[model samples]
Target: MKCKILPPKGLYHPVLPYKQLTSDNTHKLLFGLCRTCMNKISFKCKHIDDPTLNKHDKIHEIKRCKECKNIKNEKCIHSDEERVIVGTWSTIEIDKAIEKGYELQKIYELEHFEKTSTDIFKLYVDTFMKYKQEASGCKCDPKYCKNDCKNDKECKTKIQYIIDNTAYDLDIDKVKYNSGLRFIAKICLNNLWGHFGMRDNFTQKNIVLLLEHITKIVFNEKYKDISTMILDENIVLTEYKEKEEYSKPNPSVNVYIALFTTAHARLKLYELLDILQERVLYMDTDSCIYNDDGSEACKK
Candidate 1:
């Protein structure tokens, strides 16, 4: 009788060398084999751990396995894994948070200004807002309005009231103090109107899309889908444009303006500090830690 030859363990059937297949093809083949072995052995191999691969990779692997396994008596591995869930805030809640933040900044500003005996600083802010509202013809209550009134050219005269009353000539300290106060106030006055405008009866689908768009932007991917969704020519974009033309508060424009003002204030503060030769170690929206030597110089 002729001697019978047997294949090695785990290779009873013909197998291709890994180098013969492309990386993707090899991954699919190994993934299918791993799944079959896992089902029979009731465990996974360390080399083909699920956690090591990302969701997309895992999905692709499983999909390939299902397609290939149909041709043979191989078992298909299916995962009941779900995508990550994100929490969202209501527009009302967001508005409340913004208001609370502004109030906190105001309180801090008041305390600091009062400590420095700069009552005129508070008066200047009040006067600026008063003129600003008058110039803009914004009917919103001054207490709640996040709109900056100083952007109006008509508010220049009002600003002159501040300059005239607060001596820039008699004291360089007063000038620097007022400059710092103006920047801090600018930061406090900012609001997220663009995000606010997008607020509708947000369903789960809409939130998911918004989150996806934000992720795309963060990852530096082309986000035209989300952009078009936001500026849909048929409905939202056209309607918003018409409303804006009528001098209505455009949420998009408001958001851009707020951002610009905040940036301008930050740069202006840095410039003022540079002029005073003060080294700012750390800074945030409303406050900063500068060289303590000239700390009292810009108290207001």
Candidate 2:
């Protein structure tokens, strides 16, 4: 029930016109000011540190200052109200949310279920279709291939055409001889997703699962206790930033790559990576060791 709020008990009256002052049943002081002044003075005079709300425990168990979030301050104060608004996770509604969470992932059922027999095909498809396979592509098979087809007139003509087009029309490829790292692969994904939290309609739940999947593939490989193999190998996670003094507003991507490296690398690499996810983007990885200045290379 909405309590009839009166002036805060034991407090003095407000000076000039402010928003309609409402005191809770307990008469805790409610404060507001004109929007114009609120906008102007908020950065300086807004009492962000509410003493009572500061001491109160939060629902998500998230340990953060309430005012850290400029927008959600009021909505986040439910627990501070004379009566807390309990959601499905509260005494009344928790069971329902849990039941829904376990009702089976809707997307999985819709896409993978078979109609013929009531048997769910999820386990088989997941095991076979997604069981990690070697990442393979056509690398110029240097050692063994002597394809007779390469001698064919049509094939030779086609290859000549490509070479001529590159030499005369287009500038020959600059990145073909070496791997072209995406200045920041990891950060790129994060920024593009953060713009509005993904172009593909993904709920927060989908995001959590996506992260879990990527983390598993990255850190927990199928190789059993081959821990020593990874230990011997050098791993590096990199995030790129273009400027030194002033930086892109999105620096969080660099931090994400650093965190990922820490999780996957046997050697401690935390000192090398710096930046927060809110600021940077992710780039790529290189499997090698180099001198501090990078003039000398340590082959991986």
Candidate 3:
């Protein structure tokens, strides 16, 4: 399965030697989902205790499964007889999971993954990079800049160097010796990515001083999830998430973009992990700590 778009959701039966499978961290029936697709699916597995049933006939039977859902790295079903809803995964992860002994059984697709040739953020990213280059002159040579040059062309070269390296930008290093450019850059990018995935039904808060206000809030069908806290005899704090139709969606919010961004990030991390393997000590969303044997393991 060579998927150029976002990953898919499926049920896979466990095979032998499950050490290499990307085990679901949530350990739930319905795990990671692409909110854009809402690919929530269900399956029915048969469990029989007949002694005449062979291992193959054990069809969907999982006996004394050591690792139920959510148990990390532990073998779940005793044999290939059971099929578990092992969360949504990218095709790369699916390939690795198969290599580690998992068989795909079923998949439910509510909507197809989105793909396009047009770069959505081309203008924004290009503008940001150009602005960063122009704002910082050659004199502000960041640590990432290996060569010390005195011309504007060399300054452009420095920007190119920053772009090629893993370090996001010189502003990241500027926090200590220069200004709070890192935070400024981070918030801008964070908000940019977040804007595309903002939920319409955010928890809203209201300060109530009148009895009618409390009544209006409590009886409002628009506010599906409602809660109130009284700070004073006349003052109350009411917090609730509005129903979908009643809530206003952000005009810029496009779940497809958000899903693509996240899916690509996971694949990148997975690629790094595939290289590190046993050497990986700890890993986060975009970073990792691994045991290096002085062989420049990352370069591999």
Candidate 4:
């Protein structure tokens, strides 16, 4: 429910005027923004910061806050000398931060007019549920199962056909015991979201039989990261990614589904982090390590 109906669709960059972009209920994401610089200082010049101070200019040519950039402010007032830029965050993050009293401005944002279609993950979720029930009590044969089977079920032969194939390595073993049927079912449930997030531009391969074609490709500014290999005197293999204007989105990929899936997962993680707070020892995208200290937060 969180992943589907909550994620907005057809987001706009730089956001439409007064459309009221807010992640109040729809989405959640990690936010890191400048708090001290918020509404503290106003700039008087067009040059906000010295360019020479930016050692890694390639990563960011402009080292000023979006607020400063918006008003063409010349001076930066951030306390941290190394951190000249105010930094950017995703739309959801910005909205949540704003609510938290971080007076950051958004020069661009992901804004949508409508919510995501509920049917995006409905097929996969339904299939996962169905197979999860079927494989709930199923176990593996000792001779066929590669992992240590707990032998929790009597209906081993029901999914024997699936057990005969390769055992999939899914990391949900701690939640539920692994069996071929469950593994097969897990792959079906988990793998498809990644495909929807496939990169829009990938290195395209071209075989050149003539010098004229190779020269033409080399001179084209639309192509980037070009690499060429000489197969023979007349044959050449060229590979390159296209610039944004020349690149096309893959027909099968929908980035909204992928981003939404991750946003919901992060929301769940943030809930735990809020509970654990100072007790959190380490954390990653999918896992967290914390010291409960008899707080009873993890008991549920």
Candidate 5:
């Protein structure tokens, strides 16, 4: 939430109490996606039912959802990749989408930049750390835990405990964004915390909590009995669970990257599956990263 450019104090993406599109001036239909980047694709004006918008006073059937699959604040079942294969998106690619999405501020003019290798690296690193705490979740004292610890099998209630509770709360080394470190972090976080982005039903805090619980489960030595557990790799993932996957975007237009990645990853997952000896390999997240063999463990 601390944008490198703005670095505004106490800056968190505040949520609208109601799902009204017209609530924010930037929330209007056909408006650029500077505010809800991922939401652009999945939250198209033709689709979606944000009570906040209240545009349609007389409509029976819902139109398609335009918010990008990757946006955390928007709502959509399919990620970017799924939406592309279905051909529900516009012809715009990441670069165009970004360009088209930008709305110059009254205070500052807009500036365009190429999608150079450097920018890609920056995005990946930003994307990685952005979801790390969410993957790692929080730590907690058994007595003060408030996240329904008694109910949750994994009772991790503290997150970045050192970052927030240490005597030097204001003193910290900023985590730098690098591809090497980011990818590793993503693998770990995605498997544990799932992904967060501009989409409905997502928040920086929630993702962090999930990740904390994951680490707690591992360190607590609970999953040691995976042999008899009903776990999906790690978390009790719902079918629609995902991390970094491109979800359908809202009308915000910032989901261009998600749309691009989803389209590529989805195609690769399918094309690579046919070449594999086991169809199951296609289901693994790493198939896109490696195609050496179809072995189960190797698949991961």
Candidate 6:
């Protein structure tokens, strides 16, 4: 069956408010302010003489006093550098820092920072919701549906009909909003990198089985002893096994590469926009807000 390919939809155009011309750099600045606030209110460990322990050696250490055993306690060798500081500063502190040009070394005497972070968070949520609503209104059938229409000829025909009838000239605002929302959602949901990189327990078992079979085939007499030697409870064997496992093809590497390439493409597009003399106010992974001066270059 010959399937007709539909032309891509036009990109979204957003009308940015003149008052709220903040960029992604602004959020980084706010995060820095929060970090400063966090630093001032948080305490440090007094036990600076404690020596750091190796991972295997630390496993053998017995539990001691609260200060010594607690991972939150900075004195504990197991305590991480980032988690050593405890407690958050008030919203008033953040406001004061902003007002004082982010130079506030100490926490503000008042509690102004309370709603500051929440307000920013709410803005993101609201923006995401708006775009989600717009995208949800798409009446056209999707190209593929895994749940009900896997390789169904009728389903494909219906999808093609929708695609043929659907208008490509969507509202610019809706397009921009949906794109931004998708980017934000991806940021939150694309935490699969860790899982992707993790070794499959089943795959590891299979590898061990394969090794056992090979050993038995090669050295029938000393197969058991060789197997014991190969699978010894030591770091050397463990490291070797891990190296062998990782040397095989990984789907996660391809996923990471795809994500990185997408980011690189976006960066290159931003560079092109700079050459075109456009004033970019904000940009996410997929979408960007720039001054639309009705110029041919700007439109392109």
By TM-score, who's the top model here? 3
Measured on C-alpha atoms, candidate 2 has an lDDT of: 0.28
Per candidate, the number of residue pairs that clash is 0, 18, 1, 3, 72, 6
TM-score of each: 0.21, 0.14, 0.57, 0.52, 0.22, 0.22
Report lDDT (CA) for all predictions: 0.35, 0.28, 0.54, 0.54, 0.36, 0.37
Tens-digit lDDT string for candidate 1 (1-300)? 111111122322111111123323432222112222323322222333478889789767765564345434554343312111111222232233333231111111111123423243355556554333333322234442234534545444444455565433222112222334454545443333234334332222232245555454435432122322454433322111122223334234433233334444545454444444435566555566766664545553
Worst 10 residues of 3 by lDDT: 13-22
lDDT of 2 at 234: 42
How do all the candidates rank in terms of TM-score, highest first? 3, 4, 6, 5, 1, 2
For candidate 3, lDDT tens digit of each residue in 34-99? Answer: 322112222122334578878875654543333322233333333222323334444545665566
Tens-digit lDDT string for candidate 6 (37-142): 2232233334443368675544445333255435432331222233222123333333432343332333324322233222433554455444444443333345
The digit string of per-residue lDDT tens for model 2 on 1-300 reads 111111222112111112322222221122222222222223322433445454344322233434545443433222213321211111111222223231111221111224334225345423322211101111234531224323555534543454464322221221122222222433443344254322321212111234455354445433222111122234323222222233334433443333323333312221122212112233233332323432222111
Candidate 1 worst ten-residue window by lDDT: 102-111
- Flag regions of model 2 displaced more than 4 Å: 1-71, 74-76, 79-119, 130-132, 135-300
lDDT of 5 by residue, 1-300 (tens): 101111111212211111224434454322222233433434434345557655464233344333333343444445333322111222222222224232111222322446533254455555555544333333344333334332344442233443465432221223222345446777864442223234542322212236565455445432232212235544442122223343344454344455445545544554454344243322544444435564754554
TM-score attained by model 6: 0.22
* True lDDT of residue 148, candidate 6: 37
